[model samples]
Target: MTTHCDFGASLNDYLRDRLVSGIRSESAKQKLLSEASLTFEQATKIVLSMEQAEKSAAALSIGRPERIHQMSSVVARRGRFDNGAQHSKTHSQTARSDNAGAAWRGAGGTAKV
Candidate 1:
């Protein structure tokens, strides 16, 4: 209706009413309707705010678990790496101790401290 015709003085009211009625969200519609007087600009602002809030909520709901999963996987990998490092360190110490023992035995147990 706005494309082909002009409402002149009633244009703002008509646009505001049309926007309030055309929205799919019942909560937004109710909020808009509760207002005694609302302009088209006000309605658009309310709708945009509501839409952004909903999008934010949806992104958090979907993204939070994935972020947790990624963090957990990183922790798991770090744990495995730490365990492997510990094992390698123990093996290296054992090999050094064994070499020292061999050196002592090769000296007929008379190696100086």
Candidate 2:
């Protein structure tokens, strides 16, 4: 037969260890207790939920599809901008002409004759 004894260390030590191990933060634990008014078991469940979410996100990014898509989109958009600059020159001339008309109207329709 064996007897079990509770460790004399404060609960904070356990919480710090869990947080440092990427399980949950001390602030999060406190928020669960104070803000959420959750019991210890409920707080543990919340912490586990957060941990699972983090794991799931990490798993999703392991393939790096999102990062690859972002990089490709950036490259494609840059290419489009470079190609569109030539087209933009003509459009800008038309825009300036429109702006001049607007300015003429704003100046009480007095033509620059």
Candidate 3:
């Protein structure tokens, strides 16, 4: 059997250290280093997931207020807040066509249409 010379650190440990050093975020680097016997696979998964979440967050922040208003309007039109049940067919039709009639009715004004 042939024996190899012993390095101070195992290859996996060396690779893990290098991976931690390459991370741009100081907190992320610390998080990886804090793990007990962290494996390269685990570090890669954590970093990748963090990156994906950051991208999603950035995308959402671009039109956040407008997106929220649109979502709320859709939910209201779908009668989601009406006792958790959909509006009757007639009301649903009117709401789908023009929400102005529903708004007028709610404001104590009769819609001629």
List lDDT for all candidates, in order.
0.83, 0.64, 0.78
Candidate 3, after superposition: displacement of residue 8 in Å?
Answer: 11
TM-score of 2: 0.45
- Judge candidate 2 at residue 108 and give its lDDT: 95
lDDT digits (tens) for residues 1-113 of candidate 2 = 11264645545455544543563466555556464334445656677886788789898889698889998898787874474454535887889888889888888997452
Q: List the residue pairs that clash in candidate 1.
A: none
Best by lDDT: 1
Number of the predicted model whose TM-score against the real structure is largest: 1
Give TM per candidate: 0.51, 0.45, 0.46
Least lDDT summed over 10 consecutive residues: which range in candidate 3?
1-10
Candidate 3: which stretches are off by over 4 Å?
A: 1-9, 65-113
Residue 44, model 3: lDDT of 87
Better of 1 and 2 by TM-score: 1
**Model 1 misplacement above 4 A:** 1-6, 63-113
Better of 2 and 3 by TM-score: 3
